[model samples]
Target chain A: MKSNEPSFYEEVRVNGISRSDFLKFCTTMAAFMGLEASGVGQIVKALESKPRLPVIWFHFQECTCCSESFIRASHPIVASIVLDKISLDYQETLMAASGVQAEEAYKTVMQKFPGEYIVMVEGSIPTENEAYCCIGGRSALQILEEAVANCKAVVAWGNCASAGCVQAARPNPTGAQPVHKVISGKPVINVQGCPPIADVMAGVVVHLLTFDRIPQLDELGRPKAFYSRRVHDTCYRRANFDAGLFVESFDDEGAKRGYCLYKMGCKGPVTYNSCGIIKWNDGISYPIQSGHPCIGCSEAGFWDNGPFYQHLPSIAGFGIETTADKIGLGLGIATAVGVAGHAIVTNVRKHKEITNTPETVAEPETKKV
Target chain B: MRSRTNPMREVHVWELPVRLYHWVNALCITGLCITGYIIGNPPALMNGTEAYFNYWFGTIRFIHFLSAFLFFFNFLFRIYWGFAGNEFAKWTNFIPLKRSQWKEIMDVIKVDILQVTHKKIDSIGHNSLASVIYFITFLIFLLQCLTGFGMYSAMSNSFLPKLFAWIVPLLGGDIHARQLHHILMWAFILFAIVHVYLVFYHDYIERRGITSSMIGGWKFIEEDVYERHETESKEKAEK
Candidate 1:
């Protein structure tokens, strides 16, 4: 089967993508991956010579947004070339086979590839109950464990696989855990976001394909090439933020004028992503550019970081919503009142002691002396 | 009664450096709290036609960074002064190592917190309880610096702030670090309220000019208490 499969270059040629378009696609990938100019040639050489690497993509407790984003990689040539380059042996959403046939393809890939293939996980694993998420009567945890046992590396597709997205939010009933937390002794690359930008996802794949190893990762397991700088750092509206011009309301004049959304509860400053740079839907307007504040979808526990409309997160675990400032201000006022009350009490008690017995106060001093 | 009539002797409790540190730290804390509040909840000022014309937020951040540096250095100076300053200003007074220091703490708590006894516990400098509380406050100060510097590390390329880059992930992430730093500002505000009140109350009850001591570096101690303390120190030194 390996010998019969066409090379990525040959497949791209058959798919009607000209050599110039294919080379342009490679160059775009190299730039996205933060590789130098020479990287374009390296990518072309790798894709032309090397056999397509086997990829086993699994879906668990997630929507198929990672699949959607991947298949829609801005350019049709990119989507087709990347699809052919990876030789995706099994993907739950995109694969044509289902039921017995789908399970057969998955099992065949595991036995066939051994440690030669990469396992790309799309969602979190529910540790609380196996019934919470199951595919073909097998638990998600079971499927993930079996997939990771023989994979070259694991690519956590989105926040779901990276940081346990919405399903793992506050009071996460499913007890969902990210892929890295569940699996160890394997290199896991976190492409973090609600649905990470398609170009970023493609860049990571191209990097793995070219280097035949994982790229440099940040502390959070995200590839430093894309997630190193924050969206705020690269934002075009940063100058407006520095100038203190902000959108007070969604429908205000500042908003229409493209003022900074910091006052509108933008989490761009804290979120690490390439949205401001790579953007979505082929470098079109991202969330901030379209006048919606970032929900910090790339960050862990983003769901629990209070309402998306507020800047400060609500302090967790009081059985009700309350921001840090609310609690802090309450405590401050209480302390001031308590101090005033104590002062009154002290003065009143002193007055009473003076009126009652002057010698009583003097007796303690005399004894101490 | 005899001690009340005894001549009051002016003892130099705080050195000049200690006094300077106190005032500077106070100013830094005040500026930090105000500027930090603005940073957390910035006002939506839509002034000027172009972004380049208004630099209010930038100016606010500059002041915050400036005060933070001043506050950090001032705190370090105080730590050094604890070792190098006069005996009353030494670290020993705040550590609560000795039995007598623990007893004084209990006595102060009883008089101040419980209000069960009218007995006033007096010391020439800061009482053991106040010194110990200040020690805990100093720890909070250090945490504030760590979180503040950690958040700044993302924005600053300087070598100093970069040292604290690990604190953000150590405390989970940038959001948590910023939350802790913001909440601590309120802690400082509450501390100020209790601190100023206690100072005035102590000044009235002890008649030691405790409020003015910070400014003048002198406290009036009863002759017998000062004499007893002097003799005890001499004996301890001899040992």
Candidate 2:
């Protein structure tokens, strides 16, 4: 934020933070990823070799907390690598330029660099009409669409752009949509959280730079390397899920003990994100880590699923004990015919192999003896 | 021990192809159940870092797909055999709509439930009850294929999705279709349990070669049983 002096991050990295602290941060990042301790070397190499990537950060219909969380990233290099080293060319919240100058800079970088720039959008786009959200007399949606046209890769900064966030919830009068809806051709990486973890955002950029292609993505277009599993899958609270120890009320003792929030309408089982595994704020905590339920903001249309505090009767794939009927008509289907069909096909195949000799036919003239 | 008291039945009751289909179907059904449970309820951590027992998922999937192709083609051949095979396995053998044959089913069910002893023997092609079960299992098998492909279509993103797109709306959409597919999996389990039990009950307990027929193609059909079926026919009532 201070344009003149060396920032707090630079001050610490150069003179204050010892080599152990620097190595500790690198090792901490690698460990948070469930990787071996030796992976810290890869991170150390990139930071030591590469000066900083140029970033064109855009803001639209959002609270701007993505930028805020990023600055406060638990690791000091997160901000140093992103904000200082990368030379953030233009950002509404953090840059020195303003008014016509900032808009002009944004356009110039996208045009001059063309396929070399990483476009970062931090909010949902209102499709109903640009009138609802206007920046410099242009709609937020219009700015995002134009900016991404020539960009190399796009990072949807938070749930607002990754999924439509609350702005695009059911009966969304503004007709809001996430960045993916308006984007095509170019690869878009959704770093989804209410405000994504700082290092996760940093890791994505580093990954793009370290390997010239974007990370693999899941069906939802969130990075598969990050969002490959449900928060429930890797949660320390999994024992409670199998044991059925659930939080009946927000203030109950169970919640304090950090019991599973599934029964209290936590969509962690169905919603895939890295919050449980890569706890936010330098792996210090996530929403579930802080004793609150995941609202499933990363998933599309999670807002329409129902009240966040009221659990659905049952998730469709949950065994017969939690069959769909128990949850009423919220969106679970346990159609007996569908699963039976899969099983029958599986059975038929197994039967054939057992009957058929998959054993290699002995050569007509050869003898092993 | 008692050689003369129990006379041996002569000849095989099942054709080779038929026996192969039977055994293939049995093995595939078992494999399907194992993999189906795995995909349905993914493995949990037993040890700290051990991955799930998921290697079978791929193997089981390949096996399941191949077996389905085999079973379906075998079904086509079985239908053809009904028209062209030996008299014991002919199309005319399973016409349960005939009247005294219907009476035979009522008496058979009563005899089965009560464990009643009957001195009269029946023709080997299939008794009325056996014919009905054969038809039911065939329909169940058909349904299993439909539901199986429907769920696989959810992931395969193949022609099935386009062909059965109508099923998605009928069942309430992709997720619901997947759910419906899961719930119906148990119906197959129940059907399989009953099928295996009845086969073993007849073969082991009743001393009938019902289980062996799919392998041997010939039951010990006494001449007296054939004579009884032919003479007892009441088709003239329709004339």
Cα lDDT of candidate 2 equals 0.63
Docking tier of model 2: it is incorrect
Tens-digit lDDT track of model 2 for B99-193: 86788788666544333333232555566777777777677666666656654444455764345434533442233443455554555565665
Query: For this target, which candidate reaches the highest TM-score against the unseen true structure?
Result: 1
lDDT of 1 at A126: 98
> Model 1: what is its DockQ?
0.52
Error of 2 at A246 (Å): 3.7
- State how far residue B36 of model 2 sits from its true place (Å): 12
- Model 1, A114: alpha-carbon shift in Å? 2.6
DockQ: which candidate is best?
A: 1
For residue B176, what is the lDDT in candidate 1? 80
